[model samples]
Structure formats: C-alpha cells, structure tokens
Target: MAAAAAAPVWSVDPRTGKRREQVAVEATAAEVDTAVRAAHAARPALADRAVRAALLRRAADLLDAAGERVIEAADAETALGPGRLTGELARTTYQLRSFADSVDEGAFLDVRIDHADPALAPPRPDLRRYKIPLGTVAVYAASNFPLAFSVPGGDTASALAAGCPVVIKAHPDHPATSELCAALLRRAAADVGLPDGVIGLVHGFQAGLDLVRHPQVRAAGFTGSVRGGRALHDAAAARPHPIPFHGELGSLNPVVVTESAAAERAEAIGAGLAGAMTLGTGQFCVKPGLVLAPEGEAGDRLLTALTAAVSDTEAGVLLDHRMRDAFLDGVRTRAALPGVQAPVTPGAGGEHTVSAGFLTLAAAALAEDGTHDLLLEECFGPVTVLARYTDEAEVAAVLARLPGNLTATLQLGADESAGRDGAGRGARLLADATALAGRVVVNGWPTGVAVAPAQHHGGPYPATTSTATSVGTTAAERWLRPVAYQDTPPALLPPELREDNPLGLPRRVDGRAEHA
Candidate 1:
C-alpha cells in the first residue's frame, strides 16, 4: 500500500473571495510528529538564558528588516488593509524584543528558598524552589491577528523565553505569512547558535489535532472560536497524560451605560460606541457585542447618533468568506427574533462586504433568559446589540445573564467619576464589573488591548480555559512548572538554588527578599 498525497493549503484573498496562491501542503501525521520531535530536541539550546535572549532579539531584528514584505503578504491574504497590518507587524516585533528583555531580567523563574528551622514544630528542612520549562509547546495560530497572534506571536515568544521550543499549527487563513515568519524565526535561532528546530510550522486542520496529541508537546496555547477552542481543549484533556490547554476562546465583552451617564453625553457615547463596535469590522475578541442602555430621551439621542454614524460608515470585507456568511447569518437570526428591531440592517453588502449595524431590544426580555439568549452570544462582525432598560434592576438582571467575558465596561457620568452624589452606586457598579471580567473599563471602549506588564487579557470560562494570560511577561509562566529541591547535597544543587546563590537571581531566602 502507498501513502495518500498530501492536501494543498491555499492563501485566499478575502476581498475577492479568490485563492491568491498555494503556499504549502498540509502536514501529514508523520510530518507533524517530525516537527514536534525536532522542536523537543532543540529545547536544551534554549535552556541558556543569554542564548535565548539573543535569539529573541535577533528574531525581532529580522522581522523589522523584512517589514515591508511581511505586511504586503499579510494584507493580501487577510484583506485587513496595509495600515492595520503594518501596525500589527510592529506589535509583533515589539513583543519579541520585550520577551528578550524579560529573559534577561530572569524574574519569571520565580526562585524561592527557605533554610532549615530547628525551632519549628515539625523542624522544617532546607528547601529551594524554582520553575522549569514544561517542554515543547504547540501554538495554534489565530485568523484575526495574522502576526501578533500567529507565528512568532506572544505564545511562541513567551514559550521560548521560558526555555521551551515551539511548533506552530499555522492558521489556515494566513499560511503564507506563517511560513514567512517561521523562516525568520528559524534563521534567528541559527544566528544565535541554536538549531533550526527551535521553531516549527505546520498547516491543515488535522495537523493541529496531531500536534496537540503528540507526546513531546507538553502544553498547548490556542486562540479561536468557542466551538473550535472547546474541541481542542477536550482533545488535550483526553490525552493519556493530559496537558495544560490554555485557550482564548469566545467573549461577548458587554458594556453597561448608567442612566446618568447617557444623560450627560448621549451623543458622544453613541458616536464612540459606533466606532468601537465597527473597528476591525468588529472582529476583535474584545469588541463590545452587547450594551445595556437606559430607556429615555437621552438613550434615544444616543441611538440616533449611533444610527447616523453607522449609516455613514462604509461596508468592509471580513477575514474570509465563511466569516462574512456567519456574520450575515448571525445578524439575520438576531434581527428576526421577537421584539428585536434593526436600527440599521446588518447583512451582506455588495456580495463580498458586510455593512455595520445594531439591534435594539427590551432589557426585560434578556433578564430571565428565553429565545433572546442568542443575543448574548458573540457575533463576529460589524454589529452590536443594544438592550433598552427601564431601571437599574433591569440592567442588573440583564447583566447577570451574560457569560464570562474578556472585558466589562461602564460608562459613568461626572458625578459617578468624581465619587460625589452617586459614589455608592458607582462603587457598586465597579465591583460588579470587576466580578464579571478580567479587565474593567470606565468611561471608555474595550477595542484596544495594551501589551503591558500589568495587563490581564484572560478571564473566566469561554474567554480563556485557564487562569493564565496569553499576553504580558507572565504569559511565559504558562510553559513552566515549579519544582522544589529538599535538603540536597550543596555541590549537586543547581546554581539558582545553591546556598551560595551563584546565579544572583532575585529570590526569597529564610522568608526574606534577596535582590540580585
């Protein structure tokens, strides 16, 4: 018997709904195994912090050097526009360099030590603890962020920073861009005296399944739809030795507008909402999908402004035809629901593009959860759902029905902002927002996510699978596991845990902080 021919992977242009080119063939099961094993074999090279840091910096330089070519390819396949793709590339390179700096800092190791205490009840023995790389990580690239969340993205950079080599399951939407970025990363590894196996890329849906199931792949990171992410999560858990599956799934990212806030600047709020919801064709994971607004003259003014802004906005192409169809279907379903009125109809535009729009409904309908529950789900295009509420209790009722989200935003009035007459109400709302989301916004939109140390990009179920973040310095922590050494011979101990503290890493000794 002979092997079957490998399937071809084509790069399609979203704008024209045509295949741009055939980038590569789908990786077979054997190929996926080879990629995983190769990455696993190269893990030792990343164990050295200095070499790992150099590799990251070199990768960033190479990416920046090829910025024009990279952006061109990304824009062609994704139809995201040159301007947006350029910024995404910049963010990707910045992330690589930032992870290199984090590697040098070495705080992610999280070393801790405690000397023997003879006076203690149980006579505690000497112990030293620190984190070690889990092993080779499998990264599932995302469709929306071809660069920042795809190849050479945060997951890959952070895994390498934690001394784990990576094998990326390239996103079907951007295979060519993935191949280009993977080549640069491999070149970087070789330049820094590491093996080309330090980075690996594979294409196809089945390849993703094979990569996750490979024994050598110790952990996995993913970004995609709830259905897709949940399926992968289940696969990882079903493995004989279940691996940690950290997935950024779906999010509704609801927004709440107090009556006073709407009264203060309904027009401004409406215009801002229009911009945020339609940004990136409302493809952002943090895009505000549902908003709770009050029912009154002020709210009507807000709706009027939003209607004008969205009507004036032009239609745009999504990442793919499937997403365009899904967006249209979602809009149609929600629009046809009882009491749901389309202020501006959102559906297919010019056969290839989709126009932006919003749906209006009574908050009371969403309070107890009936057929209107569909509105709470995320619709991945330029559309939003506005629920008109009669009172704060109605607002609370609607909010309580919402699922876990990446962010929860509150539009506050002047009195609320200053903690004046409505201080108690503001405090209560803030607390509620905090309880519902990982990141809470006050008087602002949830469209942009900053790559900062203090940023928390993960939240409760559906938003992410684990408590860990997929961004920031702490993201590296996901690929590491802590190990404690107990009363080992002095000479046999690793330098980081040795009594002499040869590495000079920041650690806690005898319950006291020791700075390098």
Candidate 2:
C-alpha cells in the first residue's frame, strides 16, 4: 500500500485556543499587486447591481449552511462558548444579507443627473453624477470578531459590493478561522462567475504591512487597538498616494445613571452593567467601561449591587494572551491607586481567566489630579470603573473631560423629563454628552449593536478617524466617490442614469427628483 500522507499538525493557543498552522505567506510586493490587479480586472462586471447582490446573497448562503461548523471551529480555536459564537455567526450572516439588501435597494449608487439647458446664461451644459468604485481595498480582519469582522465581514462584503476588490490581512489571532472563511468567500465568487481574487487572505505581520503598502491597494478597513489602528492609519496616510483608512479603534463607552433611576432600580442597573461588561469576556469595542453615578444612598446602593454582582461572576478567557495580560495588569493598577476601592476585585480567576468587576473613586479625586486618572483608560476586559459625583454639575464636568467614544448611554427615570424644568436640565446634559460620542443611547445598553438604517457606528477621533461613517449600509459610501459627467449624450451615460433609466432607480433629473 502507498504510504499515508502526513496530517498537518495545528497547535491551539491556550489563551484564545486559536489553532496555529504554518500557511504559505504572500512574500513580495509584486505578489501583493497581482492580488489587487486581479480584483481590479474583475471589477467592471461585478459592479452590476444584480451581480453584486447575488454574490453577497450566495456568501450569506454559504455562511448559513456552514454556520454550525464555523461556530465549532471558532469555539475550538477561541474557547468562546457555543452560544455566543453561534450568535456571532448569526450576526455575521445578517450583516452580509444587510449589505445585499442595501445593494438591492440601489440607493447606494446615489445617482444625480442635470440635463443641458442651453437657454441659461453662459450656455449651461448637461451634468450627471454617480459614485465610482475605489480601485482595491485592504481589509484587516479583527481578532475580537473573528467571524463578523474577519474574512467575510463588513469590510470585505462592502468593498466587494462597491465593485472594489478586497485583499484581507487576516488577524493572526484567529488565522485558521480566517482561512476557512476566506476560502468559502472565494468559492462563492467563483460560483457567481467572478474572479477568485475578488477576495484574498494573507497571513503574517509582514504580509499585512505589505498588503497595506501595496501601490494598488486604494483603501483599508481596520478594527483593533488604538496603537495598531493608528500605525496602519499613519502608513496609509504617509504613502505616496494616501488612501482612506476607516478604522474603529479604542472606546470607553460610558453610561450615566441618574439619581432617580438608581434609587428606583440600583440592582437592575448593576446586573445589566455586569452583563454588558462581561459579555464575550469584554471583547466588544462597545463594552461599557465607565459608569457615572450620583452620591449618597443611591450611589451606595448601586455600589452594593455592583459589588455583589461582580463578586459572584466567574472569570472568562480573553480573545488572546495579550488581552489577558492587559486585563490583569489593569486590575492591579486600578486596585492599587489611592482612594480607589474595588468593592468587587476582578482578579485573575484562573491561569487564563479574569472576573468582571468595578472600581469606585470619588469624582473629586479624578478632578484633583490626573495621577488617578488611569481609571479613565479602557481596561480592555471584563472590568468597569464607577465614578461617584457629589452633584449633577460634577457629573457634567467629568462628561466634558471624556474623550471621544463610540457610544454614550443615559439611564433615565420614567419621569426624568416629564416637566419643563427637568426637561431643560436633562436636555442640556444629554446634548453635551452626545457631542462627545458618535452614537448616543437613552434608557438602554450600548452593547447591543443593532443593524439598522439610522445606526452611526463610528465615533470621534481615536474611536474612528472619519466621524461621518461606521460599518453599515452607509459604509459603502466610503469605497466610492462621485464623478460628474458634463455635456454627455444620453448614449454616453451609464444605463442607470440615462433619461430612459431602465433600472427604475431613484435619481435626480433636471435639478429635480425622479424615479425610473
């Protein structure tokens, strides 16, 4: 009998349990361009609305079909419980379908046309405008969201739908899962008669930098720590021809609980905060990292509930060893600071596990000196800091000092603004805090990121470089730029913007809105 082939040995990292393997790495600048060129060459045909939508739907189908298997692989690699991983898979698929729906709606094309009016002074000419695809996109798959933000995630899906080819710099934290997902996406592209290069995945730190620096890579999407994202952002900016780098970096999502709300339901708020902080081991960028509460009984009651809730909670593994180390070190630093009290110390529960807990300090201490201000930094794990204020004005002061964030939540009592007097105060406070964040939430947790039309997922600097966008149907706008064609014959216009517009899409004609 012929000798049996040797099976590839994949060792799993205990921190995230991500299976490790030695895959062929893309080595040269020329190889990087080849990948980008392949995508660019395939762009024209894939730009068709029907073609893009079908491919997106097919990708969704593949993910749906392999949902359980993908979840199993992710769990085996990351140790994220099946329940959460399964939900992540569902969210990831929903995101794909969401982009497909956006394409089907066709509003993303944003067509505008102005016909010639020679009678006007200076002999006005016909002008028509439509969004054109950016050439090729480089996507940096995120570790926290291996499924949703990796290979087949928003960046890849949105870029592909925009007719911009994508080259993914796979997040090393979950390379194995990234490989599987990328293969499935490539197969989907082939099924739709599109080039396999429509999606590409490369491993290694060097390979990622090469992909980002490749002359043909027109733009990139990143989700990671502030340090990592900033480095890539600078590289993209410093290139000979700078490109757009849409990145969602660090955030300390703060939640404000009014005195009235705390008085009515301290325990409920504590329990809810615990769930949000510890969800997926505090891996979400939107995790509530800070809490601002009023003083006296309400604050005491909140502390009591928070302490009890955190103490009872068990430790959970982070996405990787680096994160685990940061979490432990953060707890140690905060717990050691003067005037800082951890009613519930979120210490290391196991070798690779840490508990969800909180640290409390007087607002005066934070205001007095920046020494204890380390509390303001994000711990990047299942931990939160509660800052107690003596008055509403103090709370407002602290809110003013807060850095840009992805989300800022307000926990209001039912009658928080029922009367004119209360409404004025609440409105002013909410407005001030809202100005400091990208998305403002009222009476709900910021952890649940809903995929909806009005969602603004991006935030101020550090939260995201571009304040105007986040990962949504709106994200497609980033991969496209409007080109105005002047004095063009109807025959020369793109089919979608022609006078007889066969697609029946909404468009601006002769300075007025029209359909079909």
Candidate 3:
C-alpha cells in the first residue's frame, strides 16, 4: 500500500485573493510526532538560564537583522501594509528581548525555602520549592499580526523563557513568514550552542490536532477564534494525560460612553471610537465591537462625528478571503435585524476590501436575551455596534448581558474622572467593567495592547480558556510547574535551592523575601 501524499500549503495574498507561492507541504501525523519528539529531546539544552537567555537575545538580533525581508514576506501574505508589519516586527523582537531579560533575572522560578525547626511541638523538615519547565510546548500561531502574534510571538518567547522547547503550528494565512522566522529562531538556538530542534514548525490543520495530543507535548498556547480555540481546548483536555491549554479565543471588547462624557467631548469620543474600531481593519482582538452610548442630543452629536470619521476612511483588505466573507455576512445579518440602523452601512468595498462603519440599536433591545443578543457578539472587521441607552438601568441591563471580554472601556466626564460627582457613578461603572474584563480602560480605547509586566491580555470563559495571559512578562508562568524537595541533602540540592546562594536568584527563606 502506498502512503498518501501530504497536501501543499500555499502562501495566499488576501489583497488580490491569489496564491503567492507554495510554502511547504502540510505535515502528516508522523511528521508532527517527529517534530514534537525532536522538541522534547532538546529540552535539556535549554536547562541553563544563561544559554536560554542568550538564545532569546540572539533570536531577537537575527530577526532584527532580517527585518526588511521579514516585513516584506509578512506584508505580502497578510495585506497588513509595510508600516503595520514593520511595527509588528519591532514589537515581536522587543517581546523576545523582554523574555530574555526575564530569563536572566530568574524571578519566574519563584524559589521558596522553609528551614527545619527541631524545637517545635510538631517538628518540621527543611522544604524547598521552585518552578521548573513543563517540557515542550505547542504554540498555535495567529492569523492577524503575522509577526507579533504568529511566528516569533509572545507565546513562543514566553515558553522559551520558561526553559521549554517550542513547536509552532503555523497559521494558514502566513506560512512563508512562519517558515522564515522559524529558520531564524533555529539559527539563533544553534548560535547559542543549543540544538536546532529547540524551535520547531509544522503546517496543516490535522497537524495542529496531532501536536496537541502528542504525549511529549506538555502544554500548548493558542490565539484564534472562539470555535477553533474551544475545539483545541477540548482536544487537549480529552488526552489521557491532559496538558495545559492557554488559548486566547475571542472578545467583544465593549465600551461605555457616560452621558456626561458625551456632553463633555462627544466629538472627540466619537472620533476616537471610529479610529479604534477601524484600526488594522478592526482585526484586533481587542477592537471595540460593542459600545453603549446615552440617548439624546449629545449621543446624536457623537454619532454624527463617528459617521464622518468612518465615511472619510478608506476601505481596506482583510487578512484573508474567509474573514472578508464572514465580516460582510455579519454586517448584513446585523443590519437586517429589526430596530437596527446602519448610520453608515458597512460592507464590501471592492471585491477584495471592506469598508468601516457602525450599527445603532436601542439598549433596551439588548437588555433582555433574544434575537438582538447577536449584536453583543464580536464582528471581526471594521464595524462596531452602538446601543443607545435612556438611563443608568438600561446601561446596567445591557452590560449584564455581555460575555467576558479581554478589555472593557469607560468614557468618563470631568466630574466622574475627579470623583467629585458625590454619587459615585463613575466608581460603579468602573467596578462593573472590572467584573466583565481582564483589562479595564478609563477614558481610552482598547485597540493597542502594550507588552509590559502588568498587562493582562486574557479574561473569563470565552475570552480565554485559562486565566494566564498570552502577553507580557508573566506569560512564561503558563509553561512551568512547581516542585518541592523535602529534607534533601545539601549535596543533592539544586544550585538555586542551596543554603549558600550560588545562582544569586531571588528567593523566599523562612517566610521572608531574600535577595541574593
């Protein structure tokens, strides 16, 4: 019997809906297994913190050296423009260096020690605890930001920082970019005296499934749609030895415009909303999809400003044809709903691009669950739904019905901002936002996500499969597990756990923080 040939993976241009080139063949199950095993084999090479840190820095340097070529390749497949791709590449390299710094600092290990107390009524033995890497990780690349969220993204960087080898499942939208970045990462590993298998790449739908179920793959990180992330999360759970699945699924990043806020800066708020919702063609996961604006003259003024801004903006190409079709269908369906009005209709611009716009409906309609509930769901394009509310009760009702989000924003007025209203209306709204999202914004939009230690890029339920973030310095925590050694001999202790601090790692000794 002859083995079936693997299907070819092509790099397609979303701008013209044409195949740019054949990047590689879809990996078969055997090939996926090979990649995972290879990654697993390279685990020991990343055990040294210095080596891991060096590898990350080298990877960032290599990516920077190839910035022009990398950006060109990503732009060709994603249609995201050279400027956006350049920024994405810069963010990607910055994330790599940040994780490298995290590796060198070694705070992520979380070392703790409790000395033996022989005089106590119930004697206690010496116990030392610290985190260790969870072997190889399977990273599912995203389709939007081909550089920052795809090949050399935060997930891969964080996993490597945690001392885990990575096998990235390339997004179908940008296979060439993935291949190029993977090669650079492998070269960096080799330059640091680590095995090339420290970084792995595979392309295929089934290959993604195979990678998650592989016994050697201890954990996985994902960034994609709700349906796809949920399916993979289920697959990881169904495994006999289930692994941790950190998936950034979806969010209807909601924004609320207080009456006073609209009165104070209706034009500014509307213009900002237009820019935020249409940025990157509204492909950002944190794009404000739903907004609650007060009804009356001020809200009307805001709407007028929004309409002008969106109308003046040009139509843009999406990442792929499927997303374009989905966006158009979503707009059409939402527009057809009763009581919904498209202040400026959003739909296909040319055969390849889509225009940006917004839809309006009464907040009362969304207060109770029904057909209008569809309005609360995320539409991944340059469109946002504006729901007009008559009072605070209507605002609460509409907000209560929203699903979990990565970010929730509140536009407050001067009095609210200063907490001088005496009624604490702003406090209540801020509290409500905190309950519904991981990151809450005040008088700002949720379009751009910063890569910093304090950033929280995940939220409840459908927003993410786990509480762990897919961005920032703490993201590496997802790939580690704590281990405790009880009454172990000094000679047997790891350098980080020794009585005499050797590695100069930050640790907690006898319930007190000790800096080496």
Candidate 4:
C-alpha cells in the first residue's frame, strides 16, 4: 500500500494504555486505487493451482518462523495473553495449510460436463460447467481475533486459494499486527515466485469503503459488528457493478438447557458455560449471550454453580477504550430493566479493565417487545443473560423471538428421547433449534469453532448475509461463480472443462454423476 504519511496511525497497548508502535499512515483514495489495481493486475499469476497452493504453504512457513515476534505485537496491542495468542496463530496457520490442501485436492472447483442428448424434447447441446474465480476481492479484518481474522485470516486465505487476489482493510485496533502478518504473506509470495502485490494491504476507514466500490473488485468478505458489516454490505450492493458480499455480522448464540440435562449434570453445564462466556474476555463472536432454562430445582442448581464460577474469574482488559465503553454501556442499559438481576456486574473496573458478568431475567419478559428487546442484541464482552422459563412453551416462545445465530446449543440428558421419535420431546426442541441457528450443538458449547469440511460459520439474516460459510473448505466458493459452456470446441475450452477431462476432475455427464 502507498503510505500517504499525512497522518500517523499509532498502535496502543490495551494493558498499559500507551502507544506501542507507529505502524503506517492512512491510505488515501488514490493509494487505495493503486493497491487494488496492482492486485487486479496480478490475478492471472495467482490463478495457477500449484502456485496458489505453494504460496499458501510458504505463508504458513513464514508465519511459523516469525511466531514469537508476531505474538508479541498482537499481545501488546490487544492484551490477549501469550498462550491464547499462540493458539490463535496455530489455528491461523492451520487454516492457511488447510486451504492449501484443498487447492491440491482440486474438488473445490466443482466441475461438471454433459454430452449432447438428441433424444430429448428440445435436443439438448453439449454443456460443461465449472466454478471460476471472481476477479479481485476485498477483505475487512476483524478486531477480536488479531491473527486468525486479520491480515492472514480465513477470508484472505480462502480468497487466495480460490484464485482471487485480496486487498485487505486492516482493523484499527491491531494495525501493527496486521502489518506484520501482511509482510509475512508478501514474503511468502516472493518466495513462491509470485508478485508482491498478490496480497495488498490498506489502512483507514474510508479506504475500506473505497475498496468495495472499486470496479476491479468482484467480491468481499467481512467479519465485524452488525452496524459496520451492514453498511459495507449495502455499499457493495449499491455499486453499479454490484459484487457478492459475504459478511459474518453478529450473533447472540442463544443456548437452551433441558430440565433433564440440568438435573443430570447441572454443575458440569454451569462450569462449561462460565468458561465459554469469559473466554477472551467474552470478546469471541460465538460466545453464548443468551441462556434459556426451566425455573425449577435443576435450573436453580445450575444457576448457583454458574454464578460461583463466574464470580471467581478475575477481570481482564478489553481490546480498546471504545470497546470497553460500549461493553459497559450495553451492560448498564440491560441491567436498568425491571426484574433484571446482575449476578456479576460487568462494568469498567479500572481505566482499561472490565469484569465478567451474567444477567438473570424471567423468560416471559421477552415475550413482549420493549426495553427487554435489548436482551436479543449481542453484548460483545464477558457477559450473558439467563432467562428462566416456567414451561417448554415459554422456551419455544423465547426461541421464536431470537434473531438468527451462528450456533444454538442444547444440553440434554443421556436418555432423553435419544431413540424414540413419536412422543420424544427432543424432536420438537431440535426442530425449534435448527430454525434459528446454522450449527446446533448437542450438550456442548459454541466457543471453539473447528475449521473442517463440514463446519459452517454462518446463519440467516443478521448472522450472515447468505447461507455460505466464512470458514471451512467450502469458503472458497464464495469468491467463485459457475459458468457453463454449450457445444464449445474442446480445444477452445479451458482444460478443466474440456471434453477429454484432462485434469482428472469428477464431472457429472449424461444425467449421471462421477466422483473420483
């Protein structure tokens, strides 16, 4: 990125409340244009499958070599401990290598072919279909996960794997860490004989808007708040040549505890819930924000256990002062509601530290939409709300009121309708759970997201823009579109879509599927 140097951007340490490093100056519109154009010019060079895979692998290697320095910068800016940051770096590199392996597999292309069928009513012609990469892509870094969701995050990794050059808009909270990771990726590209501009980086808020509006960009991927993500999504849509925007905005991640499960293992559920809620100072996007449990002896037991565990957790620092203020403001607004109980008040304890907390309220309070509506919004800190339900109907009603979430978990008993279906109350609960969430967890938490083939980190509406995932192997599909050829000469067709199937890819032909 061309540094304007007009104004300096400082990286502040959240723990000590002081500036750590001057990363880079903000990028102007002209600089943004230059960076994006450079990325667009390098698309063909990055399109080779072997080269892309090697580039990603090299990036993983470079990150591993610079792990100590990167972790130190991330810790200084975000105040996430060295241990957690190390694990996050591991996950980030693992994600890059996983995408590299997917590129090597070649199945992500989703190629198909069909010979001409004269016996049909309309006399069909030969057709071949395969997914192709959109041109240049814009990636918006997330603030919560500095390494995994920032410069070398999943969005950037998957886009590169899909043959799309990326122009990253670094999040302001960790600009230093973003710069470090960006340098590593560029070095990896250079090592793999790829262009330096294969991955472009820009800093500043308006530069992000300029990136999505740039005509050369064909798609975008974002991970952030609902307000910010929605604005960018709308901007991408409003463009003359509108692009596909895949954004994981926000989620409440509501969880329901069955009476049987609570009775069987109330202490276990409570302990797990406390740990997940306070993980990363409750800054994780998938942290559980809402809990619905029956108001009974079992529920009381779980609450007692959860409260004890939460109270024992020491306060931790937020990512920045603005986030700390927003978290406290959210807590205060919710606590001011009538009949709301704060087991551990989540308020700003010091100049930069915040305490973990949980709120309690009757489930019926959400049935009517008023100030109680705040309960549905995501509070991005170490806090959660427990809604006590009088009966299963109340739980169902509460679930209906919730927005789409990344995950919804159910803690069930060992034999609670595990096999029986006719009168097994589990079916109804499962049905309700699947309606509101993408991944329904059974007797587990949603804090740790696994990066695998079947994993989907998205849901309806507010959770994400579309059903597509921002993680896992299928994520590359978001940066790709399908094109079908009809009766084209084999020599003129791309090798992957040729009649001879030179690439050895599995393709559907003559109404029959082939997988190899």
TM-scores of the models, in the order given: 0.99, 0.94, 0.99, 0.97
- What is the per-residue lDDT of model 3 for residues 386-491, given as tens digits with 9 covering 90 to 100? 9999999999998898889999999999999999888899999999999999999999999889999999999987899999998899999999999999999999
- Scored by lDDT, model 2 comes in at 0.81
Clashes of each: 0, 1, 0, 0
Q: Write the per-residue lDDT of candidate 4 for residues 16-90, one digit (tens) a residue.
A: 788887889888899899999999999989878999999999999999999999999999999999999999999
- Decoy 2 TM-score against native: 0.94
The C-alpha stretches of model 2 lying farther than 4 A from their native spots are: 1-11, 15-30, 118-124, 417-423
Q: Which window of ten consecutive residues has the lowest lDDT sum in model 1?
A: 416-425
- Order the candidates by TM-score, highest first: 3, 1, 4, 2
Evaluate all candidate structures by whole-model CA lDDT and list the values in order.
0.92, 0.81, 0.94, 0.92
In model 1, the Cα lDDT at residue 62 comes to 98
Q: Flag regions of model 3 displaced more than 4 Å.
A: none
User: Candidate 1 on 1-516: residue-level lDDT in tens?
Assistant: 988889999999899889989999999999999999999899888889999999999999999999999999999889888998888888888888889998888888889999889899999999989999999999999999999999989999999999999999999999999999999999999898999888999999999999999999999999999999999999999999999999999999999998889999999999999999999888899999999998999999999999999998899989999999899889999999999999899988778899999999999999976789899999999999999999889878887887888999999888887788444778888888887888999999998888878888999898999989988888999999999999988988888898877777888888888888
TM-score of candidate 3 against the unseen true structure:
0.99
lDDT of 2 by residue, 1-516 (tens): 985433333436646445566544444555666776776677777778878888898999998899887887777667787898888888888888888888887788888887778898988788888888888899998888888888888888888778788988877667678878888898888898888878877766666778778888888899888999999999999999999999988899988898878888888887888888888888889999989988889778878877877777778888777778888988998889998888788878787777778888888776654787787777898889888988877787787777889999988776765535444666776897688788998877999787677888888877888865656788888899889888777787888777777887888777687764
Instruction: Give per-residue lDDT, candidate 3, residue 266.
Output: 100
Please report the candidate that would top lDDT against the real structure: 3
Which of candidates 1 and 2 is the stronger one according to TM-score?
1
Candidate 4 local accuracy as lDDT? 0.92
